[model samples]
Target: MQSIVLLLWLALCAEQDVRERQIANTLTLGVGLCALIFLFVTGHTWIGSDAEEAGWALAFVILLTIPGYMLGQFGAGDVKLLAALALATDRQYLLGTIIGSGVALVLWLLSRRWLWSLLSQKVKNRLKAWGDESSKKQPFAPFLLAGFLLASVWIH
Candidate 1:
């Protein structure tokens, strides 16, 4: 189950990185639906046996991410993906995922800024001119994926 989720997450990250910064509804919603079905059939989520924990996770993620979504700080796909992951993850591990994602995002932003500062003014101008609009917005899926992996390892 973990392996399958990891593969799907990797695909999502790849799609977000290589294509436009949009996540497919098929992947996000499909995983969510599958997690729901798995919970019904097995009385367990991907990471735990407690259905209530999954429910809480789902609710928590929705509530937490909705404001960001509303403010346009997060894309709809990013919120959906996080909500789906919350459903599949144990509540305890969800904290790790959230924290890890925040840390990763901060580090990525800082590193990118640092790297940009290192480039010559002419190079920066040329690169900025060549860069597409999509490059300006960092994709969240990869950071989320990294967080998920970190949580998985930390918990196990």
Candidate 2:
């Protein structure tokens, strides 16, 4: 059930990133609600080892990452997404999330041109319509998702 929720969250993030280039507030709220529901259903024991420490973990993650956001490295959506994920995970996994997302962004930046060339013209045009003027700055959702998965598996 936790895995299912994670997958759903990742899918929604990816979809929103591609089409809207932003994660709607409602989407983040929905993800948080789902996490809360899952916690409620499972007696809050299934999601993470230390549910009590999540708040601190969240603050820690935010403090470490918010600087990047404020510096215009990404956007508020990404920060909010990370916070939501922090709620769903423990400290180690949260660290994994940060590292994984960062690595994903770097890799995407390095391979963007080749990846863009691989996209079909129609897809490119659609992406461009979503305000992708330079075809750079690819969405971070997919990379974040990948990072989340990797962190979940390898970090703990």
Candidate 3:
């Protein structure tokens, strides 16, 4: 049940970002807060085991990821989503998620550039309107979702 919701949330976030180049804070915050509330009331998350010092864990994660956010390496949405996942899982799972996301991002960047280079001018022009610039920005939510799901599966 929780996995289904998480997958849906990831999909929604990715779709919003790809379509609008923006992510909503409401979604991230709402998920995080709900998880926090669930933890407080039930002593366990919807997905993972009972959190030990969950507040400290959340704070640590936010602090740890903030530098990347500040450097524009990722959006605030990524940070919030990770923190929320931390609430849903444990530190070990979060590490796996980060690693998986990083690998996917690197591969995506390489493949996208290579594919763009192979496209014809007409195709490139059409794709450009869809915001496909080989050297331009790319969305991270999909990669994050991939990593999150992969990590969740592997960790469990």
Candidate 4:
């Protein structure tokens, strides 16, 4: 039930980010809250051992995300998405989520050449380049969402 809802919400958020390159605060907040509730209900905790477990899981997510965020590999939304999942799910789910994100990261890196071409085309046409946070271009949300959605199958 909670897993299904989280998966749906993750998919929706990923679509929204992929389409617009911006994740809505409402969606982020809603998803985070839902995950937290899921954790609590499962005895995972937002305030106790579960909370500590979540903290550890979140730390792992952060370890993966920080490099991406710093190296211009991913956006803040991606990191936040992982953090939200850490808050919402149990350690098992959280670890699975990390593995999923890692898979997404690999996919994104493998597709880097295409990303460069896309950026070059946009720049060559002098089109309004969106989400241009770094000098290098990035494929923002697709992979992160892919990871979350894929790993979510383990939840049930």
Best by lDDT: 3
lDDT of 4 by residue, 72-128 (tens): 777777778778877876567767766786787687678755765667665634423
Report the Cα lDDT for residue 135, model 1: 54
TM-scores for all predictions: 0.79, 0.78, 0.79, 0.64
Ordered list by lDDT, greatest first: 3, 1, 2, 4
Candidate 3 vs candidate 4: which has greater TM-score? 3
Residue lDDT tens for model 3, 66-132? 9988888767777887788788766666677778888887877678767677889987764463346
List clashing residue pairs in candidate 1: none
Steric overlap count per candidate: 0, 0, 0, 2
Q: Which 10-residue span in candidate 4 carries the lowest summed lDDT?
A: 124-133
Candidate 2 per-residue C-alpha lDDT over 21-73 given as tens digits, one digit per residue, 9 for 90 to 100:
78887777677666656656654523655666566667876898789888877
**Stretches of candidate 4 exceeding 4 Å from the true structure:** 33-49, 104-140, 154-156
Error of 2 at 6 (Å): 0.9
What is the C-alpha lDDT profile of model 1 across 1-156, one tens digit per residue? 774665577566545543567788887888888888888988888866488888888888888889988888888888888777777776776777788888887876667667677889887765563234455566777777777777778877
